[model samples]
Target: MIRAELPPYEGDTAHLRKMFSYFPSGVVALLANVGGTPKGMVASSFTVGVSMEPPLVSCAIRRQSSTWPELKGAHRIGISVFGEDQGEMARQISSKSIASRFEKIPLRHADSSALFIAQAPVWFECSFADELPAGDHTIALLEVHRGGADPELPPLVFYGSTFRQLQVSSADG
Candidate 1:
């Protein structure tokens, strides 16, 4: 079989964005305190458990993200794993409008360091450890401090261009 060569199409960044957005992903919110004020951004590229012995987790943050620098070296960072109900909150955090991100959203301080929100089904408070440059983003390695589970809620999946939830199965079947 012969493979066909594809022609290049030209457009703005939106074209590239729409192309990559096709991959479905889970939404997560990274929260940290900067100068006594809470700063957070929604992300979907968070990676999994790094070490089992020391209890560690990892995430990647773009070097160009405005909030990444402030979040780096934080004593504690809150990782809020969003449930399907938090789609609006995720969108708000992902938006460029910084002034209205936390508006109407309820957040609580946990362990005097990490900010925990009620909307998330699962979350973890991690202590800052080390980070190294990985391409255009920095791979942040964090030591787990505290975490909890909420299996009652379904995860919010980011697919194509929007957020979606898993369909529940009927018991009768």
Candidate 2:
């Protein structure tokens, strides 16, 4: 075995982020209705099917997020997995202006105050289960109360810091 000469890793934030961006992940809208206003944020760190028996999912949220403080107290939170055509929606919700995050965006609200984006490929109404401190972020574990998926709508992908769509191929080559 031969080892290739490479630069030593000094734990640079920029380089670490760039390396992390190589892995593709689906984007999701974590939202809820708080005080009659819709509060939401975009998260690519969402993981589904974490546990089956209790129906759990998780998302790593930045501790500095202004939205999380408002959302954590909500009775329920909505997780909407964006469809391929919803790239612009993700950007809108990710903006710094919290007041206008849901501007011009269609939504469906649950009785529990969970807000789901219209036309999302997948949706989950989750209750806050637990959270663990993870450096600059908190890993939030959510228990899914109810959820649904639309097979016709493919999920939006985030890779290399850009939005992408999935290309389906047959199993047989």
Candidate 3:
């Protein structure tokens, strides 16, 4: 067996982030309307089906996120799981310019003010349930009120700091 020596762990942020990027994850947009204005942010650290009985999902949000503070007080939040072709939409929503995030982007609004991205693969209307402090971020639990999925649209994947598409395999292995 060939074994190679690796460097000792130093807890470096950059190194840790680079290593973490190797794992692929689905991206989602968290959107809401606060005070007649739509607020949205992209998150790759999103998990669905956290609880079956209560219908819950979770997302880890950075502590420094400006958009979170505004959306936190909203009546409802929209979780839009990006479709494979919606990578550019994710980039635009996560851009630094808050004012232009939704510019030229098609959206759907609920009576509860939950704003969803049009044609997204999955959509969830959630209300903030609880939040706990995690190192450098907050772990938020959201109670799903309503949700829908489109099986035809493949999900967008984030891997190695880039957007990726899934390739379906043959039925016979």
Candidate 4:
């Protein structure tokens, strides 16, 4: 087999985004009820179980995200890991028009006032842990106070710039 030489590196964000999309990542909806109003955003960069003792999870958001400000100030935030079947819902929530984010989705508000999407497989009740500057984005670290998952639901995966469901088979083949 022969290998071709690659182009020289250029600091282009579009190029970076395209390269990053090659890897599959889980998607999550970050939510909160501010003064009885449901607010949320879909994030594909979410990561879980950062620390066992402190119980930390994290997600990265653009520096200019308008939703991040409202979420960080809330007493508690809800993180709903999208189920494999919730790709369309994730896209709907991620839209720029916040007005229609939860237009037809069922919701759940925790006792702590954290809002979550009802059909998601996993949900986390978290408090803001910290935020660090990371290039053009801010990395948000959250401390998980409580969480739950539905064992039957598989996670939604973002791969090659599209939503996909993970499918694994037994070793019998």
Which lDDT tens digits does candidate 3 get at residues 2-75? Answer: 99999988989899899999999999999999999999999999998899879999999999998998887899
- Model 2 has an lDDT value of 0.93
- How much does candidate 2 score in TM-score? 0.93
lDDT for predicted candidate 1 compared with the true structure:
0.82
Question: Residue by residue across 117-161, what tens digits does model 1's lDDT show?
Answer: 676888889887888899888888888888987888778988888
TM-score of each: 0.82, 0.93, 0.93, 0.92
Worst 10 residues of 1 by lDDT: 111-120
Model 4, residue 5: distance off in Å is 6.4
TM-score (C-alpha) between model 4 and the true structure = 0.92
lDDT (C-alpha) at residue 8 in model 4: 73
Compared to the true structure, candidate 1 yields what TM-score? 0.82
Query: 67, model 3: CA deviation in Å?
Result: 0.8
lDDT of 1 at 20: 77
Runs in model 3 with CA error above 4 Å? 1-8
Model 4 alpha-carbon miss at residue 132, Å: 0.4
- Candidate 4 lDDT by residue in tens digits, 61-109: 9999999999998999999999998988999999998898899988888
Give the alpha-carbon lDDT of every model: 0.82, 0.93, 0.93, 0.90
